[model samples]
Target chain A: MSQKQIAGVTIDVNDEGYMTNHAQWNRDVAAALAKEEGIDLTEGHWKVLDFIDKDFKEKSAVPGMRRMNKVGGIETKELYSLFPNGPIKKATKIAGYPKPVSCV
Target chain B: MPDDDEIKKVSIIVSRGSLEGVYPGLIMANGARMKGIDANLFFTFFGLHAIVKKKMNNIKIGTVGNPALCVPTPMGVGMPTWLGAIPGMSWIATAMMKKEMEKIDIPPVGEFVEMIHDAGGKIYACKATVDMFKLAPQDFCPQVDKVLTVGEFYEMSAGAQIIFT
Candidate 1:
């Protein structure tokens, strides 16, 4: 594990830059992370991040992409349109969860 | 070919009918979509069974010539391929694989296709194969976006990584 500062807040992250401690996550940190990823957070982006955060809290894992589209009402195209790089892995990381176990 | 970093899409050609043959393509396509890479699954030849409405659910693991099936032991013994050729053995292997997949929460073939479709992966069947089998467009699962010729597949696959499974 290594430590880095985002938005002037220091937190532990793995070699791949995924946050190691979910507790260090906050809305501000997420915004900073999104900015670093070249994403401008919008209401739709927040909808996905919020859904992922809530679902991860309850299920202890980020829901699969299919479940995200079906239940979150975010279709696959829309998801890609929002994330535009790595939707599941990137979104879950920004949402302050570990990398999804099933995402390739 | 586009440089590795320039790959914006992935076109997976599924050319086999067996569950073992098709699952890798499905998994890869789904993974690509999850990663926000455009994904297209092109089913050709017997791979059409993967998207055919009545046959997708019935994909069997190819037991004959399969060298991977083995009885677990300290010595790592494998079942002989001849035994695999025995009638009904494929079903057993399919059942075992299905059970293992269920334990890991992997969806079945049909449900997996549906999931991929919902995730915005494009599914295509080869037009020549479809015409050869006399399969109408409606004969395929609703997820299939089109029946395309090889040239069209190549056109759609431009600037994409084309993987064969």
Candidate 2:
């Protein structure tokens, strides 16, 4: 366990930097996390994040990338461009959701 | 810092045709593409069966002599190898696996390949295997981009992370 402070707020995070407490999330935290990943939060990024958050609450796991593109209403290429290191990993982590158990 | 944002690519080699052996490459390649990374898959040896039009979707699960078979269930208990070796068990096991994948919204083989292709992942056949098997272009599913020699595969995969499954 570790603590990370961003935008003057403290949150608990796992060693991998994923927030351990989902309830601590706010838009400011998302923006700060995205900035750390070298991303500038945009409407497109928010769209995917919003989908991830909503899906996590409803389905208990963020939809895989194909579903995110097809059902979550974002194009595959656009998702990559938004969270370039690894789209699903980066976006869900920033969205304040637990990392997917099956994703590598 | 600039290097952190550089787009990455991966090249995967699929060398077996068993349902267990084949799907990892498909899933990983698809995952990479969904993340916006370029992915190339090279199917060789028995792995060609994964792309073979008539056989791709019909590949069976390996039950006999397989030590790693785990029947995922609520109890978390695994199927013993002896049980797996029983007559007709492979078919039953395959059906169970397919049903489980469907529960998680994972697509079948043919549809999985199409989704990967639609996401811009490139699938290829190994030239040697295609020649050894005397397979023609039409023998493969439409999603396979081309058949390539080992040298060509290495050339295309230059600087990309390469994985064998």
Candidate 3:
């Protein structure tokens, strides 16, 4: 498979700027995750999703929870609250990013 | 090009009881599975409680000197880990952690374990630690795959990156 295919999600950019094939699905998943954790998705949520996607793309590994916490400047407690199901999995899924290989 | 056979393995060793300590293992293990890598979690010592008897998601916070618990000041004030052992502190700390987790979208321990299982990651209980702590299999979360000795765990973690969180 080519790099694009291996990456799983398709990226498309138009007049509206970059949009991913799984954008709608990601939003839906993020909304569900947010509901489960009883938090609203603010700008902070997008920031984290962006970070996870970028990091995973570059490193080919999911950012460890601590790295995410430190880079996001989010406390572990607060980060857990946002990702109650765990950030790397739930958040990546919601962000339409591939799941990291190290997760399970 | 990255060779198909060159896939890296990641193994995590969990040994603490605080939400901070426990969640990292769970999240990393699950993330590894998601990425199609070989991943495993070996729960030992106090970390065993995270996967034990439905108590994984119920981990209390270490309110003592946990840097994460501090409020923002001109500098900043954080909870010290030392306070985690104070009498009656675990209860309050756990409550705070639960509340914090609820505020975010993370699931409780039970559900998180379910998620890990669903993602195809392996979970093991440390046999020696279990015996040392007098814990039975029934004391562990139902999702555990087996009770393994440290030797067995090391064997599984061998040839992989071992992370102690």
Candidate 4:
């Protein structure tokens, strides 16, 4: 199929082996995280999201907890409260930060 | 705006010297790790005390010259930093800071350092500051990754964001 449509999002796969639709996946993941974390989509939440987005834009790697705290000004206790799965891994996943090689 | 492919790296440097200063570095470094970015913290000067085992757990707030002191907040006004050096003043400031830390849930510096390491952030000691202050590895927490020169830190910090908390 030229395009696979899911939940009104389009997924394009090219013959060159590039797979699209990751953005859609990111959005879906982010939304799920918002709900799970009880995030109200306020400026504070956006601050964290924007930070993660910027980091992704720069490093091509998901930010770890240390970098997130440094850039986002979020506390470790707060992060732990927000993400029970451990802030280092869960927050990045929710923020749509690309998976780090060490994570798996 | 450049596409994702054009992105390079994100790095942060934290150097600060108050009870509050240590928090920012620790918090930031942990946050960076959460985002999957390479994070390094260079603890130098008074900031170095936060990593030292004996001093880390018992840091005294500098009430003298502390901007927070003058703030009309619930925490009460503090003395000046210069005054903090007074023989008895350091003890009072230390006591006050210890009390405040207790009131909050903030753990001791040693514990905080462990948390940073557990979360995968890199910690380095400043060699020059160590020599200047007559500190050795034994003087610091065991979690320290290395004692490095400022030049070494800069070499590692290249192309990464360097922040002074």
Candidate 5:
């Protein structure tokens, strides 16, 4: 773990730039991190990030693509369009969750 | 300079009919998309079963001539080849394998292919195989994008890594 300043606050982050402490994550930090990914948090983007955050807090695990489609009410293609490239990994990072574990 | 050696795309070929044989290609294709890489899955020979609307989900595990087939016990002894040849042995093995895959959240073959497609991965059927099997377009799963000859596949997969599973 390493300390990095995000959104004007010192925070602990992993080597991959994911926030290590969930408590330190906020909308500003998420937006700042998303900027590094070349993403401007739009309404669609926020919907996914918020769903991931809620899912992590309630289920205590990162939601995979299927759960994001079936339970989280986001279409697979829409998720891809929202995050582009690596949706699950990118979304999880912005949502303050660890890398996703499930493949499907 | 950007890393020229980085893998920007992958084309995986699935040529086997067994359940285990089909999944590696699917997983790889999906995983490529997950990495923001372009990916394609080409189904040929026996692998066509994986795209056949009727047979995709009913695929069975390879039981015969496979040294890897084993019984779940303390000893972990491998199943004898002769025993593997027995009828219903493959069914039993397939059932157990599907159970384990489910425990880990691996979706069924049909659903898996759809997931890969939904992620923008292309799925193709080999022209030669389709001709040999006398398969019509309607015989394939809905997610299959096209039927292409080897030359056509190579044309599209240019500058991409090709993996035969």
Candidate 6:
């Protein structure tokens, strides 16, 4: 774990720059992280991030493509469009969650 | 594509039909796509069963001669080779494997194909195998993008790492 200053706040992050402590996550932090990934958070993007954050609290784990597609009402292709590369990795990082395991 | 140190593409040849044989290639191709790498799954021979419309959902484990069926037993002992020949062993083994995979959120073969395709990975069927088996285009699952000849397969694999599984 390491510390990083994002949006003028010291936040704990992992080697991959994923926020380790979810408590430090806020809109400012999320926007800062998204900016670093060259993403501008839109309403669609927040829908995914909110679903992930809420689902993480409920399941205590990161959600994968299947869950997002089936339950989160997000299509797989839409996820790719939103996050570009690997949606799970980028979404988890911006949402203050851990890297998702390749579950599905 | 950006000129970088990262591997940009991979062409995975899945040549076996057995559950164990097929998952490695599927997982690897999926992993590659998760890394933003271009991945292509070329199914040849019995591996075509993974892309066959009917057979894809019913992939079986070979219980009779599989020496490495190391799945858990009810008694926590290794599977005996002789026990594999028993009637219904393959079915039992398939059920156990499916249960275990489901527990970890791993999808069945058909859904796995859809997932990879949805994530922008390509799926292909070998033309020689399809012709040898007298299969047609409609026999393959919908996610398969093409049935490619050897020349076409080679052409598609250019500049991509070829891994035969």
Q: Per-residue CA lDDT of candidate 4, range B1-165, in tens?
A: 454543233334445566766776776665565554567888888888888888887666556665555323327675455654567664665566666654443456777687666556678988888899998778888889999998998888887777877
Rank all candidate structures by their lDDT, best first, as comma-separated numbers.
Answer: 5, 6, 1, 2, 3, 4
Candidate 1 residues B20-93, lDDT tens each?
A: 88899999988887766889999999999999989999999888997877754313688887998999988987
DockQ of all candidate complexes = 0.48, 0.23, 0.12, 0.09, 0.71, 0.62
Candidate with the greatest TM-score versus the true structure: 5
- How well docked is model 5, in DockQ terms? 0.71
Model 6: fraction of the reference interface contacts it also forms: 0.45
Model 1: residues >4 Å from true position, as ranges? A1-4, A38-63, A66-82, A101-104, B1-6, B72-76
- Rank by DockQ, highest first: 5, 6, 1, 2, 3, 4
Q: For each of the candidates, give the backbone clash count.
A: 0, 0, 39, 40, 0, 0
The CA lDDT at B136 in model 6 is: 84
lDDT of each: 0.86, 0.85, 0.66, 0.63, 0.90, 0.89
* lDDT by residue (tens digit), candidate 1, A1-104: 89988877998999888998999999989999988888888999999999998888888878876677667887766787788767888888788789898743
Candidate 3 lDDT over residue span B1-165, tens digit each: 466565468878999987777888887776666555677888889998888775665677666765565533214566465755579876775676666665454557776776666556678888888899888767877779999987888888878889999
Interface RMSD of 3: 9.4
Writing each residue's lDDT as its tens digit, candidate 2 over B1-165 gives 496676589999999999988999999998787566889999999999988999999988889887767767524666677997788888988998899787676778887887777667898999999999999989999989999999999999998999999
Candidate 5 predicts chain B with a TM-score of 0.96
lDDT, candidate 6, at A45: 98
Q: How close is chain B to the truth by TM-score, in each candidate?
A: 0.93, 0.91, 0.80, 0.74, 0.96, 0.92
* After superposition, candidate 4 runs with Cα above 4 Å error: A1-104, B1-16, B70-105
Instruction: Report the Cα lDDT for candidate 6.
Output: 0.89
User: Regarding lDDT, does 1 or 6 come out ahead?
Assistant: 6
- Candidate 3 ranges with C-alpha deviation above 4 Å: A1-104, B4-7, B72-76, B79-89
For candidate 3 chain B, the 10 contiguous residues with the lowest summed lDDT are B66-75
Better of 4 and 5 by lDDT: 5
Looking at model 6, the pairs that clash are none
Please, what are the lDDT tens digits per residue for candidate 4 over residues A36-90?
A: 5565445555666667778778877666544555566876556554554345455
Worst 10 residues of 6 chain B by lDDT: B69-78
Q: Candidate 3 on A60-92: residue-level lDDT in tens?
A: 656655456555554444444456544556666
